[model samples]
Target: MVLTVSDLAVARGGAPVLEGLSFSVAPGEALVLRGPNGIGKTTLLRTLAGLQPPIAGTVNFPEDTGAYASHADGIKAQLTVTENLAFWADVHGADLVDSVFEAFDLVDLRDRFAGTLSAGQKRRLGLARLGVIGRDVLFLDEPTVSLDGFSVKMFASWLRDTHLALGGIAVIATHIDLGLDAPELDLTPFKAAPDARGGSDEAFL
Candidate 1:
C-alpha cells in the first residue's frame, strides 16, 4: 500500500505551523521526520494519522491500513500485559498475540499487570500494539522515548524485519536514532513564515 501526502498545511491553535508539504511512502519504505522541537513534527504525524484535520491538502491511504502510535503508552494500568494486547488485537481484528508478545519480548511478563511494569516495559507493551493491529502503515511519534538502549535496538530490529521487510510503510517522528537508513523530512524549510499583515500600507500610514 502507498501513503501519500500532497501540498499539506497544518495549523495548531489557529496558527499555521507547516505549509506546502508533499511526500509519499511506498511499500517497504520508511520516512523519518526530523526537526527541532515545536516544528510541527507531531502535528504532521497526527494529521497523516487522521487524528486531526489538515489546514489544506490531502492525505490518501487505504482505509484500515493506517495505524498510529503516539509517545504516550496507551496501556490500561489494571490489565495484564497479555490482556492489554488481547484487547487491542480484538479491536484490530488481529490474532497474533503470541507473535507480538514474542516480538516485544513480553512473553515473560504476560501475566504481569501493566501498572507494575517499569517505564521501559510499559513502553514495550505499548509498542507491541502495532503488531497486534496488523496495519500496513504505521505512524510512530517518538517511539523510543522511555525505552532502554537494548530495547530501542530490539524495537528497531523488529521494525526493520516485520514492517519494512513485509512491504509495509512507516512514518516515524523521533529525535533518537532507530539505526534505520530511511529518508528524512526535516520540517525546517516547511515552517510557515510569520504573517505579513503588519507590513500593509494601512499599518505604515
Candidate 2:
C-alpha cells in the first residue's frame, strides 16, 4: 500500500512544529527527511507513523503495514545475536534469514550475547531487527547512529538492494548519508506559525 500525508501539521512539546506538509511514498520507494536540526524531522516522522496525534492533517496507509525504529536499539541484553532476531521474527511470524545477518555484518557474532557487544555492534544488531520483521513501511529516525562508516554502507546497501527492492516504503530522518536514492523533503518552509500551540484532540483532524 502507498503512504500518503496531506496538509499535515505536527507538534513537539504540545506546540506545533511543522504544518502544511504533503507527501507520498509509493511502495518500493524511499523518502529522506532533510533540514537543519530542530526542524521537526522527528516530529514529522512520528506523525506519519501514528505514534502521536497530529495537530491537523491526514495520514493514509494500510493499518499494520508500518514499523517505527527510533535511535534506541530496543534489544534484550540477555539474548544472543541470533536469538534476538529469532525473537522479533517469531513476534511477526517471519523467519530469520541469512541476508539479515549478512546485511548487518552480524554473522561472526551470531552466538555473542547482546549485552557484551560494543556500542556500534549493538546498533547493528538493533537495525538487523528490521530485516526480521516483514513490515512494508519503515519510519526510521537516526537509524545510522553509533554505526561506523563501513557499517553505514552495509545498512545503505541492505536498504536499497533488499528493502526497497522488495517493495518496502521508508521515510527516514538522518543527518548522515546512507547512500539512498530517495527524494529529499525539506521541512524548512513548512514550519508552523508561532501561535500554533496546544489545542484539543478535535484539532487533530
Candidate 3:
C-alpha cells in the first residue's frame, strides 16, 4: 500500500514535535528518514503507521494494510522463534513459511528461544515479522540499531530484495547505511517554527 502525508503536525509533552512535514511512498519504494537524535524520527514513523494521532493534517494509508515493528522485537522472550512467528502469522493471516524464514536466514533458528538470541538476532526476528504479516506498508524505526556489521549488511540485502519481490513500500529511520537504492529524507531539512512557548514545530506529506 502507498502512504502520503500532508501538512502533518504532532505534539508531544505539550510541545510541537513535527510540523509541515510532507513525504510520500509509492508501491515498491523505500524512503529513509534521517536526522539527529530527538528530532522526531520515531514519531514520524509511528505517525505514518497510524499508531499515533496527528495534531493537524492527515496521514493517508492504503486499505489493505497489516503489521508493525517497533525498535523492540515485540517477541516474547520465553517463546521460541517458531512460536513467535506462528502467533504473528495467525494474527496477520499469513501462510508463507519458507519464504519468510529464508528471507532473514531464520529457518534454522526457528526452534531457538527468543531470550537466547543475540541483539542482532532479535532485530532480524522483529524484521521477519514484517514479511510474515504480509503487510503492504512497512514502517521501521532504526532497524539496524545494535546489529553487528554482518547482520546489518544481511538485512540491507534482504530489505532491498524483498521490497522488490513483494512490491511493497518500506519506510525506515536509521543512522546506519542500509546499502540500498532507497531515497533519503532528512527531517531536519523540513524544520518547524517554534511556538509561543519557545518550542519547535513542523509537518509533512
Give per-model TM-scores. Answer: 0.93, 0.95, 0.89
The residue-by-residue lDDT of candidate 2 on 1-205, one tens digit each, is 8999999888876778898998899999999999999999987887788888888889999999899999899899999999999999999999998988888999999999999999999999999999999999999999999999999999999899999999999999998887788899888999988888763342332
Over 1-205, each residue of candidate 1 has an lDDT whose tens digit, in order, gives 6899999888766667898899999999999999999998888887898877777889999997888898789999999999999999898777964778888989899999999999999999999998888899999999999899999999999999987999999999998899997999899999887971111111100
* Among all candidates shown, the one with the greatest lDDT: 2
Question: What is the per-residue lDDT of model 3 for residues 1-205, given as tens digits with 9 covering 90 to 100?
Answer: 5688888876655466778877788887888888899888877777777765766788788766834567777888899888888888998777848877887778889899999998888888888887778777888888887788888887887777875456888888888887878899888855556751332243332
Q: What is the lDDT of candidate 1?
A: 0.87
Best by TM-score: 2
Off by over 4 Å in 1: 196-205
* lDDT, residue 197, candidate 1: 17
lDDT at position 203, candidate 2: 32
- 10 residues in a row with least lDDT, candidate 2: 196-205
The candidates, ranked best first by lDDT, are 2, 1, 3
For all candidates in order, the CA lDDT equals 0.87, 0.90, 0.77
